[model samples]
Target chain A: MAKTVDAKHIISITVENKPGVLARISGLFSSRGFNIDSLAVGETEEPTLSRMTIVVKGDEATLEQIRKQLGKIIDVVKVQDFSGLDFVERDLALLKVNAPAAKRGEILQIVEVFRGKIVDVGQRHLMIELSGPEAKIEAMIALMQPYGIKEVARTGRIAMVRGVK
Target chain B: MSKKSKTSKPVERGREPKTGSQILVDALIAEGAQVIFGIPGGALIDVFDALYDAPLRFILTRHEQGAAHAADGYARATGRVGVCMATSGPGATNLVTGIATANFDSVPIVAITGQVPTNLIGNDAFQEADITGICRPITKHSFLVKDVKELARVIKEAFYIASTGRPGPVLVDLPRDVSRAVCEGNPSSEISLRGYKPVYEGNIKQIRLAAKVINDASRPVIYAGGGVIISGASEQLRALAKKAHIPATTTLMALGAFPEDHPLSLGMLGMHGTAYANHAVMESDLIIAIGARFDDRITGKVDAFAPHAKILHIDIDPASISKNIRVDVPVVGDAKNILENLIPLVEPAEHKEWLKTIAKWKKDRPLTYSDTGLKPQYIVEQICEATKGEAIIATEVGQNQMWAAQFFTFTRPRSIITSGGLGTMGYGFPACIGAQVGCPDKIVFDIAGDGSIQMNIQELATAVNNQLPVNVAILNNGYLGMVRQWQELFFKKRYSHTTLTGSPDFSKVAQAYGAEGRLIEKKEDVRPALEEAVASPRTFVLDFHIDPEENVFPMVPAGEALDKMIDGLA
Candidate 1:
């Protein structure tokens, strides 16, 4: 019988760095109807290879299907699903908040609590840079919402096993 | 295995700086291509010029779609990678349906499409289309060769990717400049792709587990698919069934994987399948699915399909397992290798009671049709008798395809070729041409429909030009019969423009193309017409006027369970 385990999943994929690789991978996700909450891709330590971290929501069957489907792509070298593993994930976000001098102290304190850096300061805004797990990043975004955040840019989740092999 | 090994290392040749077109021809010759199906266009003029001096015979098809299907047919018939070519824009786009058809059925074919020059690629030049992008999702892999230096290697890689693993169509997009540029034609002899290794050996533990399940089950059925034929595992599949005393049911794609004449055979299963086969699957306790994906057409209602059975899916593509139906024992590897390993481990035992139940079901509701008028089924049966079930039968989709699948008995692998997944019309005639070209000694027949035959009717010229002697049996119902069947059953018989009132006389059309033609309206004429067509030296088209309203029986309506078949209005 098909297994039914629905939850968030982080899939780490290693693929050869080639033209249209990203398009092919993303096309596969869209074509298969898999829900991708977040996705991050970049060159790995080896220039010839690239790694992708995709955060998706699906049942065990869906995840397994996704993994198998991903593995079928000719350029995909390896697929690692961190579903039940000790893993560390990080998401970096840069938010430009409406920092009128009146609420400057409050925003700075909240940024300090999240260990975020104020990279830029203008007359009306403070650009804050924060990097952490997705939850932490989301929490910070929520705390800064009341301060009228102007623009936000986020690098989607990137993950690795907690321990070295 | 008398054919030269596809993976054999290339022979050393004197190094020569040649144009990319010359390299492409050399690569095809080295890859052991006997023929190419294609049309020439402005973008591919250089390649055509190079092919002029090459040994490969290029069969110029009227349409790019025909070229692709012909190549697919050749591949399916000969167990070799079929090749086709097209130009940019409309020509490349035309091959989409055929390429998708081959892809869905896992037929190994390589489509070479010439593109506008590299500088004009993104500039919206005339007759320019992003073919690689268009075929990306359908093809196993696609390459856009930007440089002449990579042409030979890309061609080699395209062929390798197409024929390996779960074989499917591959596309190579060559820019006009790339084909014209000079390069050292030292094609890569060794193909080493770190990311593209396909596992051939199944896990022994899983095989043993599957064996134990088979041994423990009171009833087991072997569900075979096209992969068995693709992997040439019919012998192994037959042995396993015989040794284990298990009943075998094939999918439409795997019509010839197991001989239908065998007592253990249940014919095809699932939608429009044999009633006995569906009943057996629903009642079986174990299903040994080999080289078959549980497609929705087979599953009917996925949740309730084979509810009482534990499925053991053995396929080369791991994704195919549990993608639709959950598999209990999933073995990922080549089906042939897994079956070879599994045959010995499985214990032999005949469930006398179970077999008796299946036999009763078969007797109770065997495939039945009226012996009146010029029935398409009777024509198919006659064709089978005439060829002794040995003809390479290719079919166009719809009622004609279903009729051929039901009535004709296939006794060997690669004997039946049809568009199963994409369900493309106009596939049969060109496919027959390819099959006849690939296997000249064997008779090839295309069972086509009136609506579908016209789609690629122009290919009669190609067939006559090549003197293929391919036979076409047009089940001329004068309508899109399959759709009309659905309309009759569900849509209040509105017809919905399904009639083909203005269609040309196929016989005269065939004669116009310099081939023999006959119109048979009587049952007595069917056998004689078939005999005459088969004996003809040139290509022959036989238009058999069949019943327009005949519907395929034992059909599981959309979203219904397999067992809940509507067996022809009660």
Candidate 2:
């Protein structure tokens, strides 16, 4: 029943900014075999503190278990499943694909359709830039595969609650 | 809850005023802390007052080091960030080593230290030191909260960073005045940083490229590392291996990624790894490295690791790719995703010649072990079989660790957990707690040595109090076996302080912790004791007093060239 889903669950947890606190939180999730989703950490309004916004995906039970276990972290003050809340999720993708003279126009056309901008064009290659949910970017990249893609780099999903609670 | 008032117990003479500490304690409990592990300090008496009335259970330990380790144990055991508190100066420094150990092992822990009063701070005053600076290198992040208003928010963020990507340890330092200052209700806020974006998904092109590589590889070998275990990709690894017909070998940290007994499975590779395994690497033309970096231990002479093979390294961290060894194709992605894409790329290639070639190497240089007087191999085999090979075996790093890798048949990936990367001596017990927490149905045992067991023996109490069923199998060789062997071979047998002669009775120690403890005096008693230990409802410790002079052979000396191995028994 353990399966890897495509959508990485995002969790926003609040905690005291103290020593060894990070280890405690990560240890909990790691122990449960929940690899962290995209992790973005920074200080909150309090100068002495910080906040960790994480995204990871697992089964319903695992996600709940992860949340419950996170409560045990010594420095953690709160755990929230931001993905389940009203939030905006976005990801960035950069792809390197071959662009022949014959296909250059078609490639540019495809890029514009995906709202992707042409970032670079070297000898016989085109680099496209796009930002959105993971699946949309993936679909765009898949469409460009037949053109003999050279390389693709992506920033995993990062999200925020739509309306700040 | 204890109906204790703040003023019920009078503050100690050297303590600060009660009102300030009460405020600190109230804020801590408001943050939902159930218990804390730490020691008291002279300057933080005000915080203690708050702790008394807040219904928080504080478990005091013998030393700050023990407190931190205890917190680490709790974190690992409960899947939570373990918290430890200590006063400034020596108290904070005492927690440093434990914090570093947790960092190395990737354990989530939160440490709190009480600094000297704000006015008296940084004056070389009594019991003051720059703990933040000293711990900066060891912690994921550190904090110094001068104002009490920031304490709540600081603690909130500490938990967040600790549990996030690639979990590690973090520290929070509070001055005496800060802990006492009154803070408003929970300081709820958002976090925004420019530098902290963790990548979760794999690159689509890289996934396709990995697929293409698998499709083209005539003699491909899959090398898995600890990240596979961390990401829980054993099932996906197996699916990819079976679909692609690629032989799989695991790095030390990824022992359980694929079934050890699989036909396409080659045992561990590297310096001390089986000769057949190393030969397979040299013979293969393609190496698909998954969730593993090319560490020196795995790739003996780096330049020669896979000279003939075109290496495809896929990892979560981009820096890990081509960090140690070179790579032809670098895929920055999760192991499971990459494997999923590769499955479709495998075109049913019944490459008989490649399989036969690898088979020849396996037959010529098969792994071997002997059954001489009181063979530890026999003990390992019996226990593994007795537990149906489903047990999560934890080993103290060294020869026994390698021996366990060599002998034990692991059918399930992630079943055999150990201190692979760090090779820490005291990691066995606490890691077993973590493993047990992860897989409650499996038998979790820490196979320890006489020397390694004593490193963090106090964890026995944690296990006992929590009622976690774990077995401690001590292979009492009376020495730090690995170091002793090195000395025996290179230093003309001038054994240093490695010998553990006339140590404390481990059985009595176990008894003190309210658990079953047995001493295996005779060789025949070993199996029965093992069975009894595994079946016991409580924590069990089996101490086997073994021959002091025995040694584990097949050692590869550090920095002495790959072939300069002193493997007499091999």
Candidate 3:
């Protein structure tokens, strides 16, 4: 009767802005065999503190274990699990697609429908930047996959609680 | 001009400018550091120079590894944040194993390593290694101080982090330039870190709930670990166990947390644990785990471990709760404080039937080994008798460790120190040196195997020079006893590379270092040798030639259930 499949979990951690703090956090995760699906880190309102939003794939017990382990890190100030809460998640991705003269018009049309922007243009390709939920980014990437995608770079998911205080 | 002179004079009077090295020394002293273990090298000359005038005493170890282990031992024995220092490159790298040992065992140790100059750090200068990076995984926290102004603060923070919240080793890498740089500030005695806070009080609700469970259960057992000693909760734990009339078992790291002579004591539980303790755990309805992590060695076949029990885990580190084995009630706090709160709430209860069952199991398969020749267990039992369960015993890993843990009856906290989690060989001798230094009035013994004794044999010189009357009892079996036993049982007696046939005569080696040495080959000489070593005022080494084929019993093979322990030799 044990659960066989892992569920997705989003955990946010606030930590001090010290060198190698990120490495310490990631090292703990890897050593404990917790798979980090998506990770995004940035400075919070306080310049000395950084917030890390990590999406991990694990069972409920695994997530709880991860939360406890994360809290044990001395540099980590707080750990909050937002997977079961109302949270707004976003991911930013840039795609370099093979946009020949023929496909340029079609790519632009698709970009318009997806609310994307053309950030850079090259001789053989056009770079498109998109920011939205992980699903929307994945949809955009899937649509551009047929157009011979040249390259892709993504700033993994970041999340915050969505509510009016 | 008079006003300017007055302002400058006030500034000079208020705070004296000192070099970073001097400030570091002052900071350590302010943090109440009494002794440090280390060896000086080129990069740390300035710091050593400053230490020359400092009030703290430094034990010059033969190697940096010895220094690190000694510091770990000092911390384990005294409950103080032990300090160690080493120079850059090889000196720093040599501390890696010892740091990992301390980290795994949760010993509070602050390891300070010298680094190359800040400008020359990445330039691959002579005797430079990225120690901060190297020790990051092994240490609780690490610092590479780029600015001399932060030297004192970093040292203070290192001590704080090392000693608090499941204490472990912390490394502070001081660059040569930073150590030599002049800084204009006095060391701060106050520490206020926003991120680092350890929970010391257990939730009353959880404690009450745990008490209710303990009261309701027909069969209950208490499992204690090293945290009981670290938090100084031995008395509280004993009081709780005695009040509840529940049998208690301690892990290897917690050997002395509960007195073995106590009637309620089930001794140690787990792989090499007592048969009765393991059986009690397997059959218990309520398991109270205090400051103990359910490590793999303790909980074999996690799914089958204590299947009928509702575990109540109490520990200071929240991470250790339900990390390996899931628990029903988790209390995160200092063991002493939590037990103090819990003992009052837990009503007196009796499990006469449960105790009877455990007692029957204990009487049925007691810890025993067949005596064909001079057995290591026999020697350990004799040592225990000689010390009257008072000497602090430190042990290296392998068969000797298991035998000591099994045979030696520990009656006080911090009396038995071993590398439990890391299982590092060569840990005992140097650690005994630290233990002797930490507790100058107590007799300290290092129960070592021949193979393990040779790992840090050079420390005999340090022990002799320091005049630390550390008695080392080498269980000489002419083979790496534990590995050979494993090979014999699991590898069809392959015996590949396990023989240490031509090992140096330990007695002669001890004499060469200006210490007393005795080689006891006969069984009758065991007590006399031990007595002589104990009575001697100087360092001594007794090589007890034990049975070569003897093996530690009551071992639960890896991945097997605790109750499925293989009892004694066929």
On DockQ, the leading prediction is 1
Measured with C-alpha atoms, the lDDT of residue B450 in candidate 1 is: 96
Where is model 1 more than 4 Å wrong at Cα?
A1-5, B1-13, B184-189
Each model's Cα RMSD: 4.4, 16.3, 2.0
Per-prediction DockQ comes to 0.77, 0.02, 0.61
Which model, 2 or 3, shows the larger DockQ? 3
Q: Kindly list the per-residue Cα lDDT of model 2 for residues B107-132, writing each as its tens digit.
A: 67888888887888779988898787
Model 1 - which docking category? medium
RMSD in Å for candidate 2, one decimal?
Answer: 16.3
- Shift of residue A82 alpha carbon in model 2, Å: 38
lDDT of 2: 0.73
When sorted by DockQ, best at the front, the candidate numbers are: 1, 3, 2
Write down the TM-score for model 1.
0.97
Residues A122-150, candidate 3, lDDT per residue (tens digit)?
A: 98799999999988999999999999998
Question: What is the lDDT, from 0 to 100, of the residue B495 in candidate 3?
Answer: 99
Chain B alone, TM-score of each model? Answer: 0.97, 0.84, 0.98
